[model samples]
Target: MGKPPLSGIRVVEFAGIGPGPFAGMMLADHGAEVIRIDRTRPGGLSLAIDAKDPLLRSRRSVSLDLKNPDAIAAVRRIVRDADAIIEGFRPGVMERLGLGPDVLLGDNPRLVYGRMTGWGQTGPRAHEPGHDINYVALSGVLHALGRAGEKPTPPINLAGDFGGGAMFLAFGMLAALLHAQRTGEGQVVDAAMTEGSSVLMSMMWGFRAMGRWRDERGTNLLDTAAHFYDTYETSDGKYVSLGAIEPQFYAEFRRVAGLDDAKWDRQMDQGGWPALKDELTALFRTRSRDEWVALFEGHDICFAPVLGFDEARADPHNVARGAFVEAGGVSQPAPAPRYSVSDTVVPQMAGARDDAGLLRELGFGDAEIAALGH
Candidate 1:
């Protein structure tokens, strides 16, 4: 394994679902030693269709019930030397489990305690059971998706779950870690998916304030208001994306599609979007997604194929950049945002280390190990 950027930073993950594991994965990607504290039971919820569960990448897992006295003591020992710890659970679940930050942070003042949840740490919906779609729904992002006059389609949990949820938690934890390293003081990060999802829509909020964004869902420029900034299907049932947002790009797009001058000049004026979209749709239908991909490969036309996970992994750009790495016969996204001179190893899948290894990595010694034996 190549040395990763987060090589020496040890992270403990109290696994929950969705964003929690994903945040852990991000830390692992950055080269942190992330050990997931998992229960023996896979529990009630599981979404393991992608074999290795892409979100579960870049971490080691350990199965233990913290209810046990020995296990609880073991965790305290781990936290005492740990840099950061993240958990996704209801407000009092961790405290009920006897591993709350109040107790843990006191054990080590330098620990960055990150807590992630659906609604937030404090709210009417804090105790409610909801998922990404629910958070997006409440945050108004879900309503902004899909075509005009249609039911609000969920954007596959990107806004709430990962974008708002995992990404935000990871960001907060890392930010706090940096501060802790410099000041030798630890703090708690309360990350709420609803808040994060709403933060992700700041640009849209700005557009709304400027009266450029419409609330009618998918009726605005970026949300299918413009004919050029949308997706079109091909003869082969595949699809390609279009983003000819600029005048020059739209002109080039029309030129490529054999559009005449009069129709081409009607960019973003009047109700010409429907006509333009219909024309482009008809033109795109003439070829498969691949054909158009080749047609617009190097153009500023802002074109791209709507490739699926497998196709995405196989695409030349993804392949060339090593976007997906294969491990344990499963393909998953590689660690992101490459650095010039950092260790770059894909964290081994699942529990690739023993308890002793995890303990020592967190600064446990033989005496501490013997203490756990009691």
Candidate 2:
């Protein structure tokens, strides 16, 4: 295979936290030369507790004191050769530092300026401080996460921080890069976690519009309401998930689960779901998760054991597909969305190489690199 699709792309990432580094990681994973401009000390926007955090993988780091005029000038010089720049900061922070879009883009019109934020650039809450939970809360995501009578459960930081913020920032940068490549005009990509969360609920919105979904939590088709589309605890305290949504799949599931009773015949009776779920709960509890897996392994039933991270990594199917790989002494998820013609590499832990040598490759002279590093 040839080099990764983004092999020749160059990115300059201003280290902040959360989604910014993740975006840069994605760029680097796909063969972009992502150079992270890290700070000398922890400040208001520090993202990682340790400099060796895995999210900073597949990149080189250059520590700079943005408050210093010389460092700021050096960053500008670096940006002149970059295809894109990523930063996750509150509005006007970059402008105040003299590295804002107008300043950088003035010198390099083809630069894709990617900005990551929880509330976006011009919202009423843009200036306020927030995190993943806060951002998803504003989008009704948190409210729809738990059981109908229970308090909403947060899905950690995945939904907002990585899903909404980081993924969107990466996508926006790629799209803007395409535009820059064609038009020679770069623009700011204001990726907001709140808006991205709302976008993720698009199908839910459609269901609500069609009266197929209610506003209450955990009462929808795919939200664990249906007896055939939820996770059930086994006798061994392990769990298995079912997604026998269609009639044919449900039939196969019923046959495999021995649900041949007259009560189970009324599969679409919404009023009987609670009773059906209770019966299934008891039935699933009679067998171990592995027993159920063996019973339905090669059948048409839509079933799978609810494996933990380690178990998932070792699963036969996942192992066969090469879904994960180890690098830099850590077993991490490999780069995704495989390409038939493009090649990708395992990422290394960031900050290992000499920043001076990396800067020299960027066209900086020996003295310039030393001065920048100091």
Candidate 3:
């Protein structure tokens, strides 16, 4: 196979939690040389960086005290040779540390400065402290989740943190990198979880605009209001998801599931959904999850067993596709979006790394490297 698409690119990551490291992981997985700037002393909300942490995989790390002027200079030198930088800090935090975009971008005109934050670089809430739940709550996503009369259920930070924040940061940085390559100019990518999460609801927003979606939680077609598109509990207490939205698929589901009642004929009758769903709930409970899986596995119905993390790892289809890989004695998801020629780099375990080699590559002399304690 050819080299990964990002084989020659270099990135300087100011490590933090959540989206920042995830974005760094994505870049490193694609074969970019990502050097992480870890703090000499653990501070703030930063978690303990462990070898088992998949997000911190595939990157070399350098420990530096940002409070020291020497460390700041070392970072500037590092950025001079970097193609991009990833930092997840609130507004003005990097400026206060003298590592803001203006200074770094001036040192390297083609540097893609990627910033990750909950509220973004501006707005009244920009400086406010927030988390994934808070960001998604403000994006109308949390309100749209859960049952009709129930309080909104948070999707455990996936929708806000990784999906909205990290994914957008990665996308923006790559886009800016392309622009920089073409025009020899760098730009700042301010990826806000709030804005990104809002963007994620574009389809729902379109449905609402077209009067096809209700503002109420769980009352919409795709939000569990439809009898043919929801999860059912089996006799063994395991769950399975059904997404037989199309007419033919739903018919196949009914036929395979033995739903011979005339009430199942009018598929789009939303008013009868609750009763039909209740009947399906009882019918599903008559069989075990495995039994249902065996019956629906090869059918036209869009059905799937709602497997837990461990089950997902051992699933036949996932195993066949090599979706999960063992790294650092931990089973985690593999790098995604397969390529025909370029091979994505396998993930490496995070651990202590000597910065001497990397510093020398960035043009640091022995004396300078010694001063930096490499």
Candidate 4:
């Protein structure tokens, strides 16, 4: 790929699960030179692993024990030239390693320090350990999901982890990088998953405050409470999602579904949602998912089949848009945003580029390279 947007950017990533690795991958995907510091035991290969985590791709890995003073010092040295340093751990982990943002920025005044935690850097729960589900639950996003009477369904790790942690961390780092570019000064971005998840609810919060949305589960317009917007099971035991909001779109949806005057008249009425959902479900079940898809294919009803990961890779629309690409015999979704002049890449392999090659390109001397000896 000819020079990506982040081609000249340098990032140092402290190895972490889910969100941290994902953030690193995003930066690397855009052509940032990302170096992942792994503390895992050396020498391991696994056939069970997916290799297409959508997280570990497009980066270089250096195994180092952060507990080691030399290793900590080495990390600082790496950050000395980095545009940004991102770490995801409980509150004190990096500070305990002696490579905290305060110390690193003291050394590299132009460095942007990005921190990701489940809670935050200074909240009462900051030092506590929690995962994506907990953060989302606390933020009320989880409760907003699922059927009206059903328990909240975890949307995997997407909401709190990727949406909150990785996305926010990437945004923070990039914003800080821009600031550093203009002023030659750096700043630290404290990105808490809780904070990000709350930010995600901004529109909902406004709705609730204005009495336009409800707190009850699955009752709000966006929460699948409306007949015009929700998922319905299909004949093949799979499903299809409908989001035919707005008067005209819902009118098209009504016409497509053969809705009568009663259904059309009270489309947005709170009292009619259950009847509407039942009617839609019955109509949807009469035909296969593909049949329904074909029926609504060209309309602006915001219709989509609820395709799984494998199905998505082979979908015609996705294929046409080049949304998924195969690399190293593995197929996964590609990096986003079609640039007019720049290239966006999917990292074909995790830890593929040589560490030695990256170091040399970054201007590391032989002695400096040698000092990172295992």
Candidate 5:
């Protein structure tokens, strides 16, 4: 295999929480030399085992006190040779630290400056503090989730923090890198979780416009309202999901499940969904989840048994594909979207490093390194 696609690319990530580290992890996994500049004092929303945190994998760390001018100068020196920089702070925070886009981009015109935030750089709530739930709530995602006549359930932090925030930040930085390569002009990527999450609901918005989706939560086809498209609990107290939306697939599902009632004929009859769903709920409880899985093993009914984290890691298909790997004494997902030619680097644990040695490699003389107290 060839060298990784981003073998020579350098990314400087200002350490923050959530989406910033996740974006850095993606770039590092794909073979970018991601250097994370962490705070000299450690106090933030960090896990107890930060060294084994999957989001911080495949990167090196450099702790620096941003309040010190010498540390700021060192960061500027580092940014001068970097292709991109990622920062996840509220508006003007970087400027306060003297590491804003204007200063860095003025020095390196080819740099891609990526900014991650809950609200965008400019908005009514841009400077306000918030988290994943607030961002998704503002984006109409939270309002559309959960069961009928129930409160909206938060999908943890996936939809807002990682899916909307980190993924878009990574994509924007890569796109801006391409543009910088072509024009030699650096630009800032203002990636906001609110806007990104809103974009994720584009299909739902279109469905609403086309009169295919209802305003009520959990009333849509993809939600939990459809009798043929939902999860059911089994006798073993485990769950299995069914998404047999197509006519042929639904028919196959009914045939396999032994549903000979004439009422199962109309699959899309929303008015009869509640009663049909209750019937399915009662029917599924008659057998164990694994028994249902065995019965549907060779079928195309869009069925899958819901598995927990450990079960997912130990699944046969996951084992065959090497989807999860053991690294740093922890089981975690492997780098995704494989490349035929370029190689992906194995993830490593994040921990303390030789700061002086790294500085020397960056062309800092022994005296200057000592002066910076590295």
Candidate 6:
């Protein structure tokens, strides 16, 4: 077995909720040796057992008292040999703790400092606290994600938190790491959820600029406005999604779904979309979700049944692709983007290593590690 892509790359993650931990998970998933600096206390977080939180997997944990100077010095020692550090806090939180990027990067010139926040390090709202929903709401994503006349639906926290904040933070950190390796100068990566979510809306922004997209939700081509690219409820109340956007795919859809060619001819006629969607809705309800799945199984109509979380885990395609794996007696998504040269292994739970053991690995002596406080 080969080493993971990020093997030998050490990361010190200041334990945080949501995107910060998620970013660390991604790096650890890709073979980075991530050490999470957990707080000595619960710190108001729910702090579930590490086994249940898959995001905290693939990394080791070291509980520390940030208020203690000894603990702070111990972390500085860890950062001295680390390639990067990740934290999610308000603008001046790390600075107040004497662990800001400037100080860390000063000590280690090649450290990639990744900062994750909802509003970024600077700006009017930088110091304010906000969650995933609030971030996406500011990014114009929340306004564009619902039915025509209905209230805008929050697409959970996927868009703003994970996709925008965590993914971008990891990406930026890696990129900065590369640059640091080449130039011997590290930099700070300010990955804001609002900025990340806004970047995700780039395509929609272009469409809006070109007058090809409407400002209202559920009225755009890709926003469930088009009959050919929406979900319909099955007779069993399960739903199936369609994306027969092109002419060829739409033709296949018409044939397989047993649609009348004459009536469904004008696929892109905006005025007729509502009626066409109503017809599709009525037609789809005639069969069960499984029946629809069978009809479109091998076809190129871009269709699939909307399976629940349990259903998704047991899905044949997902099973075939090894999309999910069981680790620490928990079933969750496996490491993604498989490598050809380097193999990605199912990550083990990180809490297995005790704090002293983790510190010893970082070259700290037993006595020095003990003096850091519990």
Instruction: Summarize candidate 4's per-residue lDDT along 1-374 as a digit string, tens digits.
Output: 46799998989988778888888888888889888877735432211223656677877677665656766777787889888988888888888889877899999999999898889889678778899999999888888878788999988989999998899989989999999999999998898888898899899999999999888888888888888888899988889998888888888887877776775688778898888788778888999999988999888788999999889998988999999888767787788767888897666676343555766765667786676553
TM-scores of the candidates in the order shown: 0.91, 0.96, 0.97, 0.92, 0.97, 0.97
lDDT per residue (tens digit) for residues 2-78 in model 2: 89999889999988878898888888989999988886664423233353567888888777778878789999999
Model 5: residues >4 Å from true position, as ranges?
Answer: 42-49
Q: Assess candidate 5 and give its lDDT.
A: 0.91
Give, for candidate 2, the lowest lDDT window spanning 10 residues: 42-51
How accurate locally is residue 109 in candidate 6, as Cα lDDT from 0 to 100? 93
What tens-digit string does per-residue lDDT give for candidate 1 at 1-374? Answer: 35777889989998778899889888888888887876543442222223367677767665565656777877887778789999999998888888898899989999999999999888888999999999988988888888987888888878898999999999999899999989999999999999999999999999999988878986889887688899999999999998998889988887777777696687878388887788878988999888888888777888889999899999998999998889877788877888887856664665343655656665768786555431
Compose the digit string of candidate 5's lDDT tens values, residues 274-299.
99999999999999999999999999
Every candidate's CA RMSD? 3.2, 2.1, 1.9, 2.7, 2.0, 1.8
lDDT of each: 0.82, 0.87, 0.91, 0.82, 0.91, 0.89
Score candidate 4 by lDDT: 0.82
**TM-score pick, better of 1 and 3:** 3
List model 6 lDDT by residue over 30-84, tens digit each: 8998889887754523233467789988887888888789888988988999999
Per-residue alpha-carbon lDDT of candidate 3 for residues 301-326, written as tens digits (9 for 90 to 100):
99999999999999989999999999
In angstroms, the error of model 1 at 202 is 0.6
In Å, residue 156's CA in model 3 sits off its true spot by: 0.6
Per-model clash counts, in order, read 3, 1, 0, 0, 0, 0
Q: Give the residue spans of candidate 4 off by over 4 A.
A: 40-52, 351-372
1 or 3, greater by lDDT: 3
What lDDT score is found at residue 143 in candidate 5? 97
Candidate 6 has a TM-score of 0.97
Candidate 1, after superposition: displacement of residue 91 in Å? 0.3
